[model samples]
Target: MAHIRSRKHAAAPQPAHTALALAALTMPMTLLAQQAAPAAAGAEATLPEVKARAAAETPYKADAVASPKFTQPLVDTPQTITVIKKEILQQQAATSLTEALRNTPGITMQLGENGNTTTGDSIFMRGFDTTNSIFVDGIRDLGNISRDVFNIEQVEVVKGPSGSDNGRGASSGYVNLVSKTAAREAFGNASIALGDASRVRATVDLNRPLDIALPGSAVRLNVMAQDFGVPGRDEVKAKRWGFAPSLAIGLGTPTRTYLNYLYIDQKNRPDGGVSTFGLPAYNFGANTPGAAVDPKNYYGSRSDFDDVTLHMFTARIEHDFGRGTVLRNTTRLGHTEQDFVLTGVNAVTATAADPASWTVARSRQARHQTNEILTNQTNLNTEFATGGVSHSLSTGFELIHERQNQVNAQTLTNTTLPASLQQAVANLYRPNIDDAFLMPPFKGAYAKGSTLSAAVYAFDTLKLSDAWLLNAGLRWEKFHTETNGATFTAATATLPESLVQNAPLSLTDNLLSWKLGAVFKPTADGSVYVTVSNAYQPPGGANHALSTSATNQASPSLEPQEGSNLEVGTKWDLLGGRLAATAAVYRSENRNELVSDGATPASFSQVGRRRIDGVELALVGQLTPAFNLSAGLAYMDPKIVRGVPGATGNQGGAIVYSPKVTFSSWATYKLAFGMTLGGGVRYVDPVVRNSNLNNATSANLPGTESYTVADAMLAYEVTKNVNLQLNVYNLFDRQYVAAVNNGGSRYVPGQPRNVLLTANVAF
Candidate 1:
């Protein structure tokens, strides 16, 4: 836990609006020096209205990708894609989705995972666990919440084994999110940020072009409001509100229809972080007391909370069946509801040599979750030819009907522990505990379920020779799980005796998933690829429970965790085409996995395999029109070479948070007058909290000690419609430890420097 201390003594001074935030970096560098533009040169005949006005102001990278449902290009997508537009999350004044995925890198961010519910949003990519692979415009988005990029307009990631694009995902990557539709032209924007513990946020967007009821209709609206916090943890908080509305209906006409809706409401304050037994000023005595704490100490419970509600509705219909055939149909209907009363600690095992005579146990979880989904996807794109080759087909069908409900309860809010303790401990720098304790009633419903999926898919790119290309795809699904209910008599002595519900259980599966790729294109801006994919995950995990095993009642059949990915990549489009570079090398595996049953200890068996080999590099867009970049780097090596045998899987451990290296970069320029400055640096190594792949027994579990973290930004265009930005997060205020609890007791820190100041206003 303690391994950072120099960004000039971390943080504590500076603010006086830091000289009005360095004078708003000077009105966007005097409007980029009065709209520079003077260097003359060659021009032989290359006009398509100046390449369509440089692709409409090139908002930094993203030349294609509509979820491999076809819109390829990202240099002909073979695999490995990243994209996070929305002007790089408003130049990093990011608002969630893990700060816009830290601008591309081998994603990692564990934060919570002690009990199945760890207060939402967890991540780990490349080395696996994309926390259910997320997605929005592309559907999915089931449980474990926390997402918001206001109304996002970009955030793709994709990467590997997308079994032909999402059906059970993330053999190594997935994260789609693209919303903010409806547009003919009309516009409006708004923003507000301001940060530092009392962080506040506001956002708004509006668009309209509706001629009322018909005539090239259009409508859009987005809204968000926040009251954020969590810099150094303490009374961590977050208050949220969201809304998105969209509508569109024929504009250029060929039959189009869209109507989207989203809504979110969140209430926060849940951060049970800090504590690592013996950190930095290590002093392992009383069995392993801890010290050097204070990354904003806040031992959970201040009336711990979490309440969320999300809503979604989508409808899309496009019809173009003319020569290039097209037919789309999308229909979504979502709902999510979460309730919480978190507060978990437990990580003190007798030991109290000092560190205020250690002790510190705390628990009080209570939950109520709900999710509902009703999807319907239908697609058909076309182009055909045969012998001379030319394919580009795409076919799809999807139908889902999901339902899930869960309720967990527990109370033992440590009234300073004693009554046979469910959580009792105190004194880790000050004893006593009680935050108006009283929060355990949420019985009813232990877990409910329903799942029905039916899918069909097809894809083909072919084109085979004008520079060879040959993607392929396949998909087939048919799952049907049931379990209308399951109970635990409300909490029989800390439950988890391996639930047993032999009545009302049902299961079924089919899954077929597949993918293949090849691209060559040596010129349209370069590409070179090779891909292979497959994915699965059937057995009732995302809610379709089957329970049954309270000491084995003939229920032990769970299957479906297959996975695959094999990649090789290259993408170019250098300078002349406005930057973009990429490289990849991958290998991922997961033959079944889900081991742990060397004679049933909570039973689980799937033959485990787990692997991950990687290499990646990237650089994106506009290296010049006044610079604009986004970088990435990776090196993963997740392991578990075989079946389980302790020490975290087999071949020596190492998957936990899986970080063998990761990097994130950010760049911005437009210097001289439209002022913009940028900075970026993020490194992450040292991980292995448990999943053994033995990094030499990861110093007794609880890993995460490498750190870099830095960020900066400044913008000004104070009047191109008003703009002003400031950003800066952890600009080296690195305290490091962001998640680790393989017994090192608790953690989750990493956030210090902090600073944000925005004011955008568009029109």
Candidate 2:
């Protein structure tokens, strides 16, 4: 068993706590006494031996997911799922959700569109966009702002088509972030860290059982504050603070209720990325090489800023009945508002004869946006027997309303600016930070959209025999969406025009998703399974936005896109159930993609198809009493199955931002006398982002090259209540491009070597 750390309650002491602390302090003597006593001749084994089993549980592995919809444990679950527990986050000093996600493979980051930067977590997984598929405790969380992990319990990533698990979503799957809640336990913990580039962060988690009329009631509060600078970059800053408070009633009784509230505020300076003039695989035409720009250059204006405010309220109740039956209901209201003014770079304007006169054209981008959601869900879990078979079943129904409102800004992209606005053209080698430019005007253009959905789903796992099991799930949903917007219009000589109002657009759709799987267990600790699943993505399903253009994918008249996945996998529990190993081979496809119709008017059709075949291997949990490890590797082959004939964009071409291989691993080992050593490595294969199908194989195309990054950590326990840790990122300081825009004109460079020291305290 792994070593256990004593937990001291901040509230009134209990008998169990005292006994556990005493037993830990005198383990050697207690073990000898147990050997001498021999359980008192089978007189109902007393509590003396309970402390042995009370040792702290391993944090590297989890047996079951927190969601009640999963009817089986991770070892028996017939899907590709990865869970990232909070302990791992603490050891790595990861403060953001995106940073923590580096533990998994086959996931890549992305820069924004042409001449812009994508806000929040712009993630690409399994060759598909997953930005809209993020959830918080089973409820869709929509926004373009970044997320903090201070109040999170664990992050669960469900791979493959999981439409049966949630409503309409990405074909690649979704990410669910579980929150921390109050329990019938009392403890207090806090941490403070300081890192390079003027980084500082602190957080506190406190939980205590109430001594009020409700015997099992408890309360928990988690708070965080941070101010940091982006490594290897100048004039960039991130500042944020947030808190989560939870209350629970009847925690240990037949009836339970929980209430939680969250609030966060942020003020940050967004990065516009450095110019990509001098990078590898880049040229100045006719096979002429270009000079690389400084990676640490800050091309954005000092006044550019992004501010956000968020609020969320949730309530849940559960009831348990005899004979293994339970019911639960959850409701949530969430809202987020963001306001940002950013600067972006386009292609460079070079003067070959005079390199010092080269300049890069700049543009302005801004948005005032808000996202809101209201949802309620009810679920039931029951276990029963029918003749010779046993069944574990889960059924649920959900009602959701989601909305997004955005105010557009008119960017000043004209190159014929007066000398007073010369800041729009920045010097390629030596830029002036004090240069000034006027903010673009807004002509009162705005867009507002909403989606309303009702869904019912059921999942069941039937145990046919000791070595055989069958799992099936089905979901049916009905949805309606509406989008309304207005834009400024220019007047002609014959008529006068002003703001033009577009008619309200509406769409309605009914969707059905299902999955089936069979498992065969050859031994008590191993299982082999094969599964097939399906998902659907209707028009305006992700963002609740519709378009009138016939060629647009979000047009209300278009049909829904369809996705399917097939997999054969195996799972094993070794090292006395302390370690888990899994391997899977999967084939996933998405059809009904929008493509050129090849007609006179140049319309579009939904006949395009894309496919990806991949193999994944993973290992997680404790390798020995003093060692812990988590690792994963993925190999992918993505192709365009059907597309517009001879089109350079998709015809028999590779998808953008999709890599062929990726790997990530992290491990930690305890040394003698309260010391630990840890390290990790991450690798991403080269990715092509160019639209020209024929140029996909060319070296000069706009894309990111393969890169590897390494990190290390060391920790030492100061006393029973305090410990110190230090983490070093980019151990080798390798220079590489982390992400590139589709236009390939700009790129976000990898971070340089940096260090952080943290102190943790518990009482």
Candidate 3:
């Protein structure tokens, strides 16, 4: 059989709404002349309020979200949300978004499929795939790549159906990353760090006011560079660098304009993972399994590599219309390019009696892909009163164009060589990195697709009384997607080889989603609320590519999947509003799944259903004047009520990769002499890789076992402008499996004990 190859294009056409979007942005500038007098007067009133709030803010707590759609403060919001401030990330020395997410519960990582290794942050949340539900500054950030936090100020996680907040997305929830921008202050900060595994990193953040040319104007810049290698895994290394710049004008005035840009470049050696032939329940020709293989074994060739380049540009305008009303408009252009070639262990050949003679089959995989997005959004927020009822209303309109192009490759072995070498086989016990292997050449096959969407949404929060409040939101969206691709097939007996170039396929869908909530405030610092929300996932929603297979869920002929959630929660502020506590119980369900319909010709229908019932608890903010804490616990029960019979891991049992119980907590205390000590513990229950009617593991072997890990941090403030910090990860050096492939053929081992020390300077 021949492989299907693909390639990507570097450029794409601008969206049709570009002109209109630009008009919306420039229209506000015309009001600058008329509002000059009022703007100056308004500036005087806003500056003092901002200064006072900044002086009273806490390091680890946020009172409200950056988005204007959420009209109420955190205490009054009905949804389940967690905000991880930059201070927490700094103290922990977290470099990637994956490490920062450890502060939350009920999230798991995923290894790739049977033949390939997953790269980047492949996140699973609340029993659903949330890899594509990440956003930056209220706009979707689409790609499969690791994200650095050097330019990030905070991370906000919202759990539950949120179609009203954004557009179509996963059933679980979404994450929003807040970027650091210009501020009306002069400050500079820098850090340099060194760690085990030849790790080195440096970062800098600087902000300054430019009042000489434009009053109230400011500029900010952030830069990062890193080079590191995996401690236990040999020949695996990553090198990356990035920079972000932001400019703001009229910050304190009634009209504000902002410009921002970001650029990143990465080069890395990917890991393919170790074979699972000797592990428990790994049967080889009816032979009993043996001891596990060395976790440090590097099975891939040294030629494998992954590289990425990213660029983004944004412009925003905000104009105060006076009387508690504001108008805002934003435009963004983002592009990402990635190319990778990796070697994975596919199967084990244990025919030899000696374990040293055993070998594992290797498979080559490569992809050249590019993702591009252009979006424009306009919003209006106002406060009004009618019939003695006060209302806070938020309305917005959005236009988006997202596209993805991927070029695949076919691998051909050098059959002239020896059998073992030509077959791409590596010794199971002792694999060599300098092995003879052939690099795959790119063919002409590729896949290209794009999605265009137009949407309008509105949200209203009504104060029925001092003790009662009602919140409602609704969104209507229309989307169109087009796909074009080609595939190849090798020649067979009595048949000639062929290359099939498919005609353009298109899908159009209209979606309506909403949410409703009611809150009851029994006291000044506490509230109870109940909310119901729904979201939709249409064909080509997560990715732009559409499939032609009848059984595939991304078939354009299929109906969109529907998800709903019902949650009841309560929140309280304690110790004179220094601490926040929250608890919630929720049930979420997804319907319209594509499944085989037991028919003679094998028909399919959209009658499948699945559900998850969970309980969550959280605490954040200062426990006392000298202590701070952030912690969360989650208990999830996932089940499939209907599905295809005998489907791997889908037999009326718990969903694959979904843990039952997860807990995470971190706390720090300030001591005398400007010293601080912090530590955290994380726990995850066992998960089943395969399921039958009895919900048993596959082949009667146990699934991934549960594990507990701990981390510690110590910091000393030598002076007001200088500090030193150290972080220790996996202090106990516990050996465990971090992730396993769906077929149970391979696994990635957890990181061993490692430490890093840094010197931080601020002025």
Candidate 4:
């Protein structure tokens, strides 16, 4: 049994100001203790477990994941699910969600924000943008901020429409982050790392059983601080710090309660990236439209920045009725805010004939956005036998109340520019500009809205016989949203309403999502399955803020987008059920997509359609006791089936950011003397932009090109309680595009070769 000899935090006391900020996040709750030094602590290591049990949990590498409400093993579930565990993250030194997701297949990043707001985690899977389809511990995170993984236990990428799991999952799928919680153990671990470009990061984790007399009671704390620079970019950097704490009462008892909280503060020197102009179809040859700028060029001002803050608190209770019945309830409150300015660019003189003459017209966008959510969930799980069959059933319900606020206005250039937004000139070929430290002047509010949603769902897995299994689920949701309709003048001398007109607002929608599947198990380690699922996304909630009906009165007809997926897949447990592999063929489509009606100006109809046909392959887990591997590949064709007359290009063509092929693979092997080696590669095919698709000018749009990058890692366990590790990213230092500025001229440059060395010690 694990026992504690002393009661102390894991780290040193935080500064008074920092302490105050943390205290605000812990308002009603109590801050038990921060992590203290591990010098006198006892070192411990054991297999992963959701809760304390008599036996240590089995490690299947990346084979199994329990997300939100899932109780079945990934191999037993019918849908395609990819699980990335803590071990995999450490091996890759992936500190953020984006870095970790790049290791999967068919994923791309897009810039999110209006004007100068580039603070969103614009991730796409399959062929659709899934920026809002992010969840933390089953609750929607409800913002466009990049999320950190410092306190996450694992990440589950559920492929395909997931409205049944979330109210408004993206057409392609959703990402669920399972956070670390209080565990019944007495162990502590800490790590500090440094890398290229003056990168510095420190992290700590401590889990302590609180009381000896109490059978099940413990508290866990996690903290992280980091300051890092973009290896290839000039003056681009990111800095952040956060803390997570969880406490459990009656952890190992029949009746248990848990409380979890998270707080994060971040600031970044945003990168607008390189331009997409003149390049050879294959190289910078004379064939393409314009010259390719050096990958290291900085087109945006160095003073551009993105700042964000996030806080969340959750409470959960569970009761076991013995005999295979359990009840669980969870409630969470979350808030997030973002402020930033991004450099917008227009090609002025970029041409292949005079490649060196390329210059860009530059402007700035300033934005402030905020979101808040209060949600609750309850579920009942039970197993019973009837007649000649056994059934595992789960039923749940959820309630959510959310609010979104956005105020976007650029800096006013009050001079010869005649009170216009900030405007400037930039030399794209070779930047000669410097940071101006310009920020947006006071502007009126543009959008304020609130939403309330409720849903009830049930799922059942029936074992008709030993060889065949059936699964079915259905969810009924009621959603309502409306504009706050508040008026504010900003108390200015001449407040022009032009800067604050209310966009289309107000909506009421009822959504029904469902799933069905059948499985044939020919062997204990293998199964073949067919599954069908559907999701509903209401009109005007695409960006979380609904379009006011008043602003969209011209177009009277609107409806929720309908998406469906049909897949046939097979999963196998190889090498004595220690390794797992999955292969699937599927078609996913979205119908009734909102598009403008040719006959009417500013009017739209749900007559558009988009679809993707694809095949996916994944292999995860151990090939041998000493070797672990995870690999995935996807081939997809996404196209538009309808068009808008005035939308200019992008119709009847491949969608933006949807690559035809993407592949990733990572493997680790253990050698003698506690040494391990790891390596992986990522490949992405060329991608197009929506606004310029199918246009002759597309050559000037700077589309993403096909590229392959590799990464490597080396680690040695000096002792059972100490380990040393190193990770090298972009091993070949390939120059490539990481992301486009989302329907804009600015594109992101990929990272250069950089290395991080870490010393991890456990007590």
Please give, for residues 72-144, the per-residue lDDT of candidate 4 as tens digits. 5566678888878888887788899998897689999986432343556788899987887887776777776
Estimate the overall C-alpha local distance difference test score of candidate 2. 0.82
| Model 2 lDDT, residue 54, Cα | 30
| Candidate 2 ranges beyond 4 A from true positions | 1-56, 286-289, 415-420, 490-497, 597-601, 696-701
Please provide TM-scores, in order, for all candidate models, with all chains considered together. Answer: 0.32, 0.91, 0.92, 0.87
List, residue by residue over 416-518, the lDDT tens digit for candidate 3: 2356664477888888888877766565468899999999999998989988889999999999999999887666898887768887788998999999999
With a 3 Å backbone cut-off (N, CA, C), the pairs that clash in candidate 3 are 5-408, 5-445, 6-407, 6-408, 7-407
For model 4, the local distance difference test gives 0.73
Q: Tens digit of lDDT per residue, candidate 2, span 1-763?
A: 2212211111111000011112233344334433432332233232233253432357788766777777887778889889898999999999988988899898988888885587788888888888888988878898887899998888888899889998788878889888888878899999999999999999999999999997479989999999999889988889999998888876655456677888899999998888888787775553235588888888878788999999888877665542446667777778899998888877677756677888878887788999998777878888888999988888999999999998877775546356566868888877766778667666556889999999999999899999999999999999999999998765689877677888889999899999999999998778999999989999988778899888889999999998889999999988888899999999999999999755566667899898989999999999999999999999999888877656545677777788999999889999999999999999999998864576544333368889999999999999989999999999999998888887777888899999999999998
Model 3 residue runs over 4 Å out of place are 1-55, 280-287, 411-420, 491-499, 598-601, 646-649, 691-702
Q: Report the number of the highest-lDDT candidate.
A: 2
Ranking by TM-score: 3, 2, 4, 1
TM-score of 3: 0.92
